[model samples]
Target chain A: MPQLKAKSLEMRTPQVTKTAVLVIGGAEDKVHGREILRTFFGRAGASNGYITIIPSASREPAIIGGRYTRIFEEMGAKKVEILDIRERDQCESAETKASLEACSGVFLTGGDQLRLCGVLADTPAMEIIRQRVRAGQLTLAGTSAGAAVMGHHMIAGGGSGETPKRSLVDMATGLGFIPEVIVDQHFHNRNRMGRLISAIAAHPDRLGIGIDEDTCAMFERDGWLQAMGKGSVTIVDPTEVTHTNEPHVGASEPLTVHNLRLHILSHGDRFHLYQRTVLPAVHRISS
Target chain B: MPQLKAKSLEMRTPQVTKTAVLVIGGAEDKVHGREILRTFFGRAGASNGYITIIPSASREPAIIGGRYTRIFEEMGAKKVEILDIRERDQCESAETKASLEACSGVFLTGGDQLRLCGVLADTPAMEIIRQRVRAGQLTLAGTSAGAAVMGHHMIAGGGSGETPKRSLVDMATGLGFIPEVIVDQHFHNRNRMGRLISAIAAHPDRLGIGIDEDTCAMFERDGWLQAMGKGSVTIVDPTEVTHTNEPHVGASEPLTVHNLRLHILSHGDRFHLYQRTVLPAVHRISS
Candidate 1:
């Protein structure tokens, strides 16, 4: 009989490839243009990594896609390619595949999340994107719409901020680059509190991150997220909130939210993503 | 300085209203049809209570709006009023105002959440609904789509499961009958886990209730919710989840969900919506 490897032994081996993620708030292009770009290049390891930009996100306008290409080039990136995925066919193009395969860093610019998802769903590019991330060859970064698409579920904006109704926004399948978290940009500035709150109340098990403009949260390989840039990131963890008396009542009933922990993190704050808790001071980056 | 008046204290006193929320999971006009009809009558009460049904909700055969009116009459409701809200003028008709003012309960039948919000937004009927709820004179009950419209924020339906990127579902403002919670019905049957999870993840502080078919969780005045009817209710409390590293990586990033407390409550299980923990058995309702 052949000797069998124990499952525990197999689990002990470290997975190759180091992955880093950068989430820039919607207005990052205007505020921390150079700094955000520098962070991406530095994280990607200037000499070893190639960069690919998905500009289809420009449909939302708030996301400045081409800006990253120019910035990355200026930062001494010899090979910078932009994949203009306007139609579904382009997402499967040979050029798109080549660029994605060669790149160590994939950047998604801000725009319309729905548009981006529509262009990339179930395509060869999507599979490649997932494979590269898993292989640790790619570090995915997004700003605004780009960042929103990084989540498995992306928010498609709709309705007003007045009520916490399900009709206030639209949700679509995102790139599935990150599972179980919903991403919202320009969170505090736009008073997206109602929408974000509704989102969490809808799915209590998932986590939400509302990155303020000019701020970024970097998710390292080990499920750790470190807050970087100006302003603060709001971590809404509803895992403990209880006692919801809602949609069944016809009249507006007072909703009681209990045991919600809100963490406001500025630059240098470190959080363990799976643990959903703030890390100790030792883990935080010195500004 | 103004003297603190006794009347001020009285004004701020918490007024307790006898409100009953009837949640119908499946076949509002067929299965448990009599019970649903009786639900409307119960809301009307013996005194000056009126019942108004919005027909616009039943444009689709599955909605069964007119059936509610017939059931209300069969259940001995003295006054059963049908308000056609499709016409812009009808939203502010004298009949609509009188029906709202004279009635103790307003029945919102099953239909589309988007349609309900669209018809009710900025309307006199909408204002009356809000006033009645605040006055504690209304017991709002909904089935299916009607139930979806009870919360301040409503879910219009979206994607196949929860992956974090936006699903195809849309969220809009609802009647605001219930604040702070997002309600989803036929949760398990329709596999709405992803949508509900997405909603809660976006708003970590709000509570999410996924009521399975034939099951209902009623939020009482004391800030407690009692599960009733057949099947079970899934309460998702994300407050204790440890790590939520989102917006930092690609869609393939493994989600780490730690310490999320999920409660599966059957009939007569009383959950405290505020505390987010299971209350002792002594506080539970005697079924």
Candidate 2:
């Protein structure tokens, strides 16, 4: 019999995490010379990179696409493509997949998380994107609603509160790239902690990550999460929480949870998911 | 064939977590009306409670144990006892186990978490304690080192830093009441966040909870962990992190992680570990 204190429980951790993902909580300050965008470009390779922008999450894809095209191009990306697919069938087209596979990095602009997941989830285009990322050929970046959809358990919509309560947050399925977490955008300005907590309460054992405006939590394939931008990244973890009155209450009832673990991260904060710890990062050297 | 997004892995979650653990992170102001102690008493049945204090974690067990004995008695506990097991062999004595089994609550004092776990882990006394807790007969409370030993993954020793780095924190097996987390004491005042982060990084999937002076993160049988203190409880979660350079570093090499989630909880904050969220608690109604 194993000792009661033993912790190796045969966890089925992810096998290959060779891709990098940027989950940027939206309304990033572009007037500040787009610091976050520039960083993404650098990660994708500043000079010899092929960058693709997917505007599917936006209502006006062409406009959003056009705006990012200029930003990335100006950042010295060798080739910036506005990846487009007008219809559902376009997602299955070999031409689109091939084109996506050729990119060094992909960016999804802000709009609606549901809209983005609705268009791209389980599609041939998404398959190619995942393949490229896992194969170490591409870096995937998303902002705002695009960022929200990065996790497997996405927050479709929710109301906000200073203190956490149940039923305040709503949830929906997403692309599942970051399945163990639920990402929220425009965190502090909207005061989304309450809703984020509710979502985490519903999906027990998963993490709730809220990114502030102009802030980004970047994920590398090895499951290392780092914070960047002017604001902070708020993380809500209910894994060690000992009590929650959620199951006993009605839909509109307030939540009561005890022992929830949380973390607040800013620039130069590094976290390893596999090791389950935080490491402080030194300032990035400007290339 | 399994779909790519399948989250249903056969996770071997710990088989035992039936007891209520109140892991207090130390320096709790007992002089100021003993608010946390009062709350603890209320959980243990208040006026009709049988409370036991184990000061083995302290270098001066007698003094530390006496202090708590007086507090619990003053709180109107029906009976207060100082459990004595002088010899290591006494741990196997049926008399010791029986005496401990009678108490409604057990409070462990602060000093060295290692010594506490060393003396009690796998002992017959501990076996009985677990049995009683599993049967919903006892509440286990601990402070400082006592608090640290509440989790299965305990931080044995570590150096503090403002930024996280490799080899800063050491790990050891604990008593295992709260297995999913790594608890740290004297958080902010001592600048222990750096070490706490390193500890969390060393053990992935488990949460890192740093409790500050005069703070208590109360856990009940319902899996709720609540903060009742002047300082905050900092939570570090790397479960959603995608990458970290920890595996590649030496003792002093700065660590790099991406997308780490964090939360800072002060007074009135209640966290649910399973739900992975924090809920704010209103002031308690005196019993």
Candidate 3:
């Protein structure tokens, strides 16, 4: 019944001013990704905010590796660092922690959510990143695999459309920067409804955010999120569903969800999580 | 904050009023699947209702084809029939239409969502089913594949994990019984958040309902949905998110989502789509 107000694109100008988190969807930092970064941080007075790229994902070497650095440099980033968490040691290195601490904004490049989670689980870098985000000292932004780990529960993937067997797929602990939510990237482009729904069904209390291939849903410090770009994001909440998943069978069976609430947000829309409704603010983009 | 109220439970009474629709998830006749059916329909008076099972879904010969009929017979049903739509003509047969029209409720057995949609698309039987549901003359219930078709859009299967390039399995026309909503079966059991999110992201206006394998979420005449099962259902709505999902050069693109509302519903939970909030009257079923 309530409409979310939109903020001017101009408000995003110099996109780096007081941003507490910078979430980049997979494929961001390409053509539009850089432009998006400029819009957000360019006006912040800094040529570029500290950007840390995590190349631990599968597609990292192909996408965010070599030429990507030059592009970010050209985009006006003052400093760009890449954290290659391919090895266990790299994930725990002192340098990784220092880079995480020194940077104002950490960017996770596209790759594998499972890989990222596996490398960073219980690691010092993860701890530092989490600490910085909670302390409001640094902004955390991730694309693709990076984005998937923002939530406490990361979706590893699984079987066919008919069977939602948890063991069929894998799940790992996420960065937990944003508690109470599960993040999915390349949403519509990949037809990931089955997986996202499976994740929500597994954890009814957690919210599921599915980001489209060319879209980004960013959450601000005040706990409001806005959608920007071409596609939309899917938000799933199962707080009001009645179900009997067991049917008096196995003790540890998959959950069954009944009545649930869902909302879809496109560019410029704002949603308040705590209030659980759309805000009244209007959003606009400025050059 | 309102809670869902249960008008009646079939478990409490062996013989009761038959519903308009009976949706059975995949494997409904299978050992595990039967329990899911018994948990939901067993309590709803599966035997007493005019039941029709779509046997085209079963991988094996519909050996258990008459299982529902027998169950409902014991539950005090006047009659039970099985419809096999395997033949091309059977899908459009006059007998199908007459049987459907004559019945008080229709049951969709679980198998493959794609298969079910393919068999019923544009057929007279499909139209009759849709019309009956809209007219409230028939109670429509589906398990697994059957449930998938309940929504306007259906999720086919695809990729394993969080890869930006994973194919969007497939989406075809469903029964359209539930307008503006996409249904995913075996939701949390298989960690389907990725797929469900993708589906919701593709269609922002539609709400996604991911029912757990053994669980079922029922929508009453008043448009309120209640969950009943051992597991939970995941609802994803992306009305408020901000991000850029544009592709980066040769790299996998990134997606960003923000500020979406999510609610987790278990047994006894209620959600009013019109109000877009959780009702206080609904509460979780304690094991």
Candidate 4:
């Protein structure tokens, strides 16, 4: 009876979004194979796609915006526009909202997360993007600082290569594009396990996703996250944690935690977000 | 008129405790000159003192507890007792409470802070020690992990050598011996400036005090903290901070903070805790 109800619900929602969010860690290869970018290009509908680039996070928005525009255009995007919304007021403009409305995909470039948030947060353009993404009308992707802002609870900056503790990372609000997890980019390359673990300890309800340099954790509308690129994606699940000293202990004390689940996913590996289960890659049976 | 009132109060209280809290960083000279320990011994009333050493933080309590006992005995302390309580139940014992009550001075040795808190926090002996220290009836000194637990907000453990952000260190509730500040031991020797700054950013209300190796920051009853020994004490005061991204940014995000007051005090230099002022060392009049 439950299966029948779920099947009916799924049938009713025929327009379910299949496009995924490409969350690339910093330092992704752009010149060579460009596998991640190529994947994004195909997912965004190639020649039929109208891609918009938001480079507000960079110090030189034009340079970064032009870079992505060329990359997407070279990959056969029909229309590529650089929104370059430098000011917060620009985010409220009709032209900005129209650009986003027409965009099949949006790419947020890397630079300073605080700058990105300063320009995009709480504006009409951002609201429209959020709504469209939720409605399966747009595919969104960000890299480096861009990837860091995908989660509702963002890791702005903090130190790495230490024991996992409350004082190991700094946190702030993000764009809320993906609200269920806290994302940390340039993971293992920068030794950010301690930072991610500390973040998870602070917000146990949210999963901690640490993406290594050149890696991507693509989240699909069906709630399955797939790992891509050369490096791996680290998932820290705090749901099974039996005990944590976070509440009783003060701000900077070493933590005592028990039963945290961790998973390292490489290319082609898939994980169901809600179910908290991993799906190993299926090997091709060559006859 | 205010001065007259203060004088009157002072006249009424002739037995004001002259003892100070000797907060030593890790690796104080145990064999060499023993300058810091000797200072502590004299302030603890030398030959007339009944000093109690708490070595619960150490894995081998008896070894560490005996080491300090011998040091004090060598320094001519007539009475020295090792109250090495390993269990929480032992902290509640009558003997533990009696030892703390009879002692004129209490010394906490270096070890694992988590273990120390597990054994001592909320126990009968801990409560007695807190009350006595507050009432100025007992002199208190701690080193390394001992010094780490002096504040209401204690830094348990975290990384170093990074930008000052919210996640650079871990904090937990300390013994609250000195409630107004957050203490970090083995400061400059370990390149912990960033760690201390992060701690201050998280807790602007509490001053971040970083004590270097073989150094001591002694807090007197009059609210003056004096630096002693070879290295300097870095005091980070967050009261002047005009802006901080801590409230808005997510966990691990790089923080943007402005106008934090910092002071580095060497041997003989003093800082007024409540006033948030620094007093330079007084040169000797050799005439």
* The candidate that achieves the highest TM-score relative to the unseen native structure: 3
True contacts kept of 2: 0.05
Give the CA lDDT, 0 to 100, for residue B70 in model 1. 67
Residue B45, model 4, lDDT: 75
Residue A72 error for model 2, in Å? 1.1
How far residue B272's Cα lies from its native spot in candidate 2, in Å, is 17
Task: Output per-candidate TM-scores for chain A, rounded to 2 decimals.
Answer: 0.84, 0.89, 0.81, 0.91
Best by lDDT: 4
Off by over 4 Å in 1: A1-17, A29-33, A60-65, A246-257, A280-287, B1-287
Q: Between the candidate structures 3 and 4, which one is better when assessed by DockQ?
A: 3
Better of 3 and 4 by lDDT: 4
lDDT (10s digit) by residue, model 2, range A76-120: 889999876556788888777877978888998998888888888
lDDT of the candidates, in the order given: 0.65, 0.74, 0.62, 0.80
Which 10 consecutive positions of candidate 1 chain B have the poorest summed lDDT?
B249-258
lDDT of model 3 at position B58 = 61
Q: Which ten residues in a row have the lowest lDDT in candidate 4 chain A?
A: A278-287
C-alpha DockQ for predicted model 1: 0.02
The candidates' DockQ values read 0.02, 0.04, 0.13, 0.02
Residue B226 alpha-carbon offset, candidate 4, angstroms: 36
Candidate 3's fnat?
A: 0.15
Off by over 4 Å in 3: A1-16, A32-50, A59-63, A85-104, A118-137, A159-169, A189-206, A238-254, A257-259, A285-287, B1-20, B23-287
Q: Judged by lDDT relative to the true structure, which candidate is superior, 1 or 2?
A: 2
